[model samples]
Target: MTYDLYIGDRMFSSWSLRGWLMFERFGIPARTQPVGLYSGTMKQDLEPLAPARLVPVMRTPEGTVIGDTLAMAETLAERHPDAGFWPVDPEARALARWLVAEMHSGFTALRGDCPMQLHSGYTDFTPSDAVCADLARIEELWSLARTRHGPEGPWLFGAYSLADVFYAPVAARIAGYGLPVGDRAAAYVARHLADPAFRRWRALGLTKSYDPMPYAMAVTHGPWPGPAPRKARAVDTGPSENTACPFSGKPVADFLELDGRVFGFCNPACRDKTVNDPEAWPAFMALL
Candidate 1:
């Protein structure tokens, strides 16, 4: 039976990403419904699933509604016994559960100071003492998982599991905010960024633009680190293709060519940002 998953904007909703990955990474069949988190329609959007006042709520085929991410994880694991949502080894599985539970209930400082944003990296943002402590704790947990259980693969438990799903947003936060992390932690974050599923989610998120960008920072934003963009060729002419900016949907005022086709942007800032790194903005990558 097909499940209905309700999610918020992909760009900023950390919890929503975790919920989606629970099904998406495991190949579970489900259809997604968007809840208006930033548009102030979240309450109305969640009205059908009464008592669940948050995004990333799921509805089972039998009409059972699940709200909390932890509950959703347990329910999915129970329903799909063959999905391998947890590690096969009992000890590893126990550690995985511990990681996910800690992620669910702790790390308030990092979560509050650095919200997940799939847009670009902040160059000047500095983490407070509490955030630094949280990062240290996260790295410690990651190291333990990798040393004991993840001897084979890039994932924490060798193969991907619910631990990775839950931490995906944490990875996004590390990348998006340019948080100072250990090399190992940085590599794990990079792995998440390079995942095709994560890329697709970020690409779809880029298709929609916010009026006032969420998590707007006064600090300088640099190009995001991940897959490198194709070498672009400078174009003398104006936009040769789309008339509207992929980011803001405004009229095209600037242009850059990648591979061969010229793409347009609403302003020089958008154009230059894309030019600096095209693949960072997956919507632009789609255009190329």
Candidate 2:
């Protein structure tokens, strides 16, 4: 059940990262092929790989083709419910779907003003009124969602679910661009950064491949605020780690540290499930 995923660099390919991460989380083995966006060769490059002008196009074993972030995530959600891609609660799941949909269809201002990248660093750039409005709304959503779900888990919902996946790019954009999220949203971003999937994503972006989209590549501090560990650099997960996940793309809440270093787990149960199988761990770990 290998899937063919088209993606951009780690620092820049939030779209591709989401799709690939979902693919990995569900255990849908995939052959990853990078397509350089904004490379001028993208159109011609994708003709053979994806045929669409997007990077995160996924071709499934059933020969079905899906593109766009929400669509791809939903498609997987429908087909891989056993993966728990969506939240379990009917209401939570519905709200999750709504948020992902909104992120896909809306936020024109932020998308335009803060393009995705991870190159140098951030500058004090002002968002247009429209982008600011989008940010404000996003922050509000986070605040509300966090307030409601915080008691259960740290993610947008109590546990990590599809909603988090879709909005992850927004967190990255805010981090890379140094946007003012006030308090609640800023805290939300920190939690996201500590998520195993995100930490892996950030670590990879620091050294090797990053999303090359102008905004994504412009990232100077990487996602984490402190300097990346000089010794931590030795873990060569691989050039492709950032593009997907190394463990399950959706690292369970228990497996990750607050800083997302993949240190020891809370107890022995996790060690048996995720640690015993080296091969299993590497799949998701490789992506990190």
Over 1-288, each residue of candidate 2 has an lDDT whose tens digit, in order, gives 667887776667778778767765456678877776756777876886455778788887877777787777878778777888877878777777778888888898898778765443375556678888999999877776666654555778887777888787788778767788787677777666555556554444544432433543332453244223222212213222133233333333333322235433333333333332222334434433
lDDT of 1 by residue, 1-288 (tens): 789999999889999999999888999989999999999899999999999998799999999999989999999999998899999999999999999999999999999999888888898999999999999999999999999999766999999999999999999998888889989999999999998678767756765788799989898988776675467654667746888888888988788887678888887767765665567665676765
Query: Native-vs-model 2 lDDT?
Result: 0.63
Runs in model 1 with CA error above 4 Å?
229-288
TM-scores for every candidate against the unseen true structure: 0.82, 0.71
> Which pairs clash in the backbone of model 1?
none
The parts of candidate 2 lying over 4 Å away from their true place are: 25-27, 49-51, 119-123, 205-227, 230-288
Q: Name the weakest run of 10 consecutive residues (lDDT summed) in model 2.
A: 232-241
